[model samples]
Target: MFLKSVFLVYSLLVLRVYAANIMGLSPFKMSVIQPLLSSSKNSQIDCDHHSVKSSKRWDVVDMLKAMAKIDSTVGYEYEVMHWLRDVLEEQGMTVEMQLVEDEHQSVTGLARHNIYAYMGKTRDTSIVVSSHIDTNPEGNIPYHEIGEEIHVRGACDAKGPAAGQIVAFFELWDASIIKEGDVSLLFVIGEEYNGIGMKTAVESLNATWSKAAIFGEPTENKLSKGHKGNFRFDVEAWGKKSHSGYPELGFSAIEFYLRKANTLLNAELPYSPVLGPTTVNIGTIHGGVAANIIPDYVKAEMYIRVADDIEKVKAYVEELFNTEHSQMTIVQYLKPQYLSFDVPGFELIACAYATDIPYFESIDVKKYLYGPGSISVAHTQAEFVTVTDLYDSVIGYKNLITYNL
Candidate 1:
């Protein structure tokens, strides 16, 4: 243990000393793993000779075309994964599919693979830029496309960001800028439900990874320092199975839940100035056995998005329900969870949604929330990523790398 502490202290000092030479951002906490990209004078090994001549705009558009062409919703990323693996293989890049067991088998229904296409064992590792490959479940969602407007699913929330990362990494790698090491790319899976893919990867503790992790979410490609997260749990109202005629034999769990919901609506949750406000939305609710029979069970799914002590928030939620719905049963509990990004110079907005950042905090990495398109267009029937936005993301990404590494 003493030796470990000594090494940890040494690591931080080494990284701090080298960070100034490379202009890379340091982590919030002490780092034990120093970057291997550092050199004698300057870490910015400019090898513009190995640069590719492809326009990032066209690259993004092409990637959107490819991502939009496939459907990787929940249990079905295999089709798109195979196609992407083939594309990477064609470029002589080594591709591997990280298969993680499905923990949420009752919900996800199948195992998933976190696809990776690495350029090589680059020794000049600078920064690890990553984006999620899987997309939200897009079913019979209606969309439109006008002149120059290309409408499709997974166009923004991720596909475009993924495109930007892929495009940039390939260019740098091919140009030999990343020949020795210093940079790598990581594309994860299962960001929506639970961070199963990232979790699996972290467990592997692969040595050939990057120093810091740049996570791409739909943030208009702006660098976010850090933000809040959540741990969501379920609160259930209980009743009894009885005949409809014998109303007294069963209490209405739905009614109990409704009562609890009314209280929450009237309550004002604590909020931080930075993260804005704490809010809750009961997205899904179900109760009753049949129209004639008195329902024995009722469940209400609670979603709480927060920037402060999310675990405390979860406890508060439980207290809120338990105090009111005293007789109710909690059929299921899913705590509100995610790590919010906060970056200076970034336009702050209330993110009532969730991301994969929370699951990644256990690893020593730099988290950036940036991507193409607006979150407003995400999961919408008319979902689409602006061609201009995709190009903009590439430029922004390059700028981020230029600033940090």
Candidate 2:
């Protein structure tokens, strides 16, 4: 008994050293385990030891701060990818980089890559946690702290959720509760402009048998039932240019755009009880060279938040455009995406914004959309996320993964 006790003490000391060195915990924080060794009950000592170790296994705040400081704007995620790769490798995960061709390679002359990390045995029934690594092109925005919030361009949009997902992954890995091939993490690019990265992943990765996939987006920590579809187009008008004073002498392209805009704004669109009514935004309009000159050409960009069948919506838009004289060119269209939420304790909502969900339609997996923060502030200059939300998401993701597994 005496020898057994001594060996157990020595083993615990070794574990403490390993946790301090390998787990990135400060020596001061590692000292919390010293008290557990003095307890008489072996089970109590083990429980206390695990509690201390888990608390210091990964620093959620530091990880989030590091991620927020990096500039991962769309088409420019190379540097951030390197940093993320190193972080995942340090946690003892097997990392894989999949090349993604840049659609703008003709202009930028460069390519990018997506990251995948996993452990344990590979299986078709693995759970996937995914999020985009790119942010809106907000330039070099620094992270700022205000009360309980952290302000940065991508903080609310996706980086916050990404960081939270990483922390949760680390927790599961450290606990050894999940075996290899049970869970995988994916970080993709091009979510802001297009879903090219996700599309590539669905094609390249053998993930068709995945049982469930959690897509991290800013959902204010609620589980989304689904989100609306998207359809975008450009309207162009052409007319003869003339002096503004003699407007009747030349047809005004600007006047044509205004008339069309008025008709679109007042037109009633189809509505759904589950997904809500279709909404439209005439996002941009440009015409005229000068105030004194009648414009020869004008173009307006519009996006529709589609609620139901995208084909029917397209037909409706086509009929509407046919009634007008302007030329309409379709840019992009995506059908509505519905997600699953078997895990309990979340309020369900239908998101109005679109995500990369539609891009993974070919992958035969149960999809889920969730995360921290809010979409309302995602692309705004004042974008921010609560530090509390970031921490809570770590727990939320862990629960989702645990439940699915």
Candidate 3:
């Protein structure tokens, strides 16, 4: 029969394109993520739990529900970065901490900190505000097929832009119009696992390169200026365990690590002008050793994202894994996806997503990147963020540092 009626109309057109990607996250992208997952502890959104900040748009919705009940997640961000450095040292500003670690996430290589606060440094360019208080334990893994609903877990990809960059860092230094030693504030932690607390905070606080470095996440504020830099690795592949009915003396390493990541993902990159072009994401893959045997040794982990000649896109991914898997080998090459901060006149954004600006794309910063919820309601279980976009991003970070210092 016409190829089983053309594979039953191509499996009902792949089940109607996976039910339109689950109706595009439904009209409920943020109806207040299920009443903030019902945590009202006895209901009181307006009934008067001190009527949440009583006004000023209900005190920016009770300060974004007290900074999403502070659960920084990822290897637990030092008690929400010491409750946001005790609310930036209760405004007087002048906090500093950097513990760094020996491994990362817990072999003892963790305990990150870079809570800086400044007020006067006049000019000579310098601005380095960053973000990544981590969160992504995913939880709720009931597995579904492509309807795109990967619920909860740093919901909008960054605690709703770290609760609109901590109310735009106290509406930019408590309205004193951010004093300006060119400006600085960087909070980071494993950026969800492998930024290794912003690479041990720019090599242990020789923080340097600061003419610009704004890198907060929840983007809806509209000034990300640019993103697209990462280059993780790991792809073994050997093979020789045998059994499964003599499969050519065994050899599969996840089928030669998916044919060397589908040949550099079918090649073609190099482009940017507004941080465009470049991306890849195999994410993970490991070896096997069961179901009738025949495994050998596999390993895979991929991540790519760079715009404009990332060393010719990493030498075209090592010449497409040395010509599509000649038994593969690159065990872990990292360090090729940069962005280590960049700024000069400021106002630039493209961030396809991923921050700590590729660990400061080489420094020299003047960074700019506004914040304040609507990353479509981060960490949804009804996660929230609209105390009027956290007091309009604390009056739009005090009018973007009083219109850029």
Q: Which one is best on lDDT?
A: 2
Candidate 3 C-alpha lDDT tens digits along 209-253:
444565666655556655665666666666678888988877766
Query: What number of clashing residue pairs does each candidate have, in the order they appear?
Result: 39, 6, 35
Could you tell me the C-alpha RMSD of candidate 3 in Å?
21.2
* Positional deviation of residue 172's Cα in model 2 after best superposition, in angstroms: 1.3
TM-score of 1: 0.74
Local distance difference test values of all predictions, in order: 0.61, 0.77, 0.54
In candidate 1, stretches whose alpha carbon ends up further than 4 angstroms from where it belongs are 1-58, 102-111, 122-124, 138-144, 205-210, 243-246, 291-293, 321-350
Least accurate 10 contiguous residues by lDDT in model 2? 44-53
- For model 3 the local lDDT of residue 298 reads 73
Task: Point out the higher-scoring one by lDDT: 2 or 3.
Answer: 2
Tens-digit lDDT track for model 1 on 215-304?
Answer: 777765555544556555566777777778988987777767787788876777767665667777786788886888877667766666
Listing every candidate in turn, what is its Cα RMSD in Å to the true structure after a full C-alpha superposition?
17.2, 10.0, 21.2
Q: Which 10-residue window of candidate 3 scores lowest in summed lDDT?
A: 48-57
lDDT of 1: 0.61
Structural RMSD, model 1: 17.2
TM-score of each: 0.74, 0.81, 0.33
Better of 1 and 2 by lDDT: 2
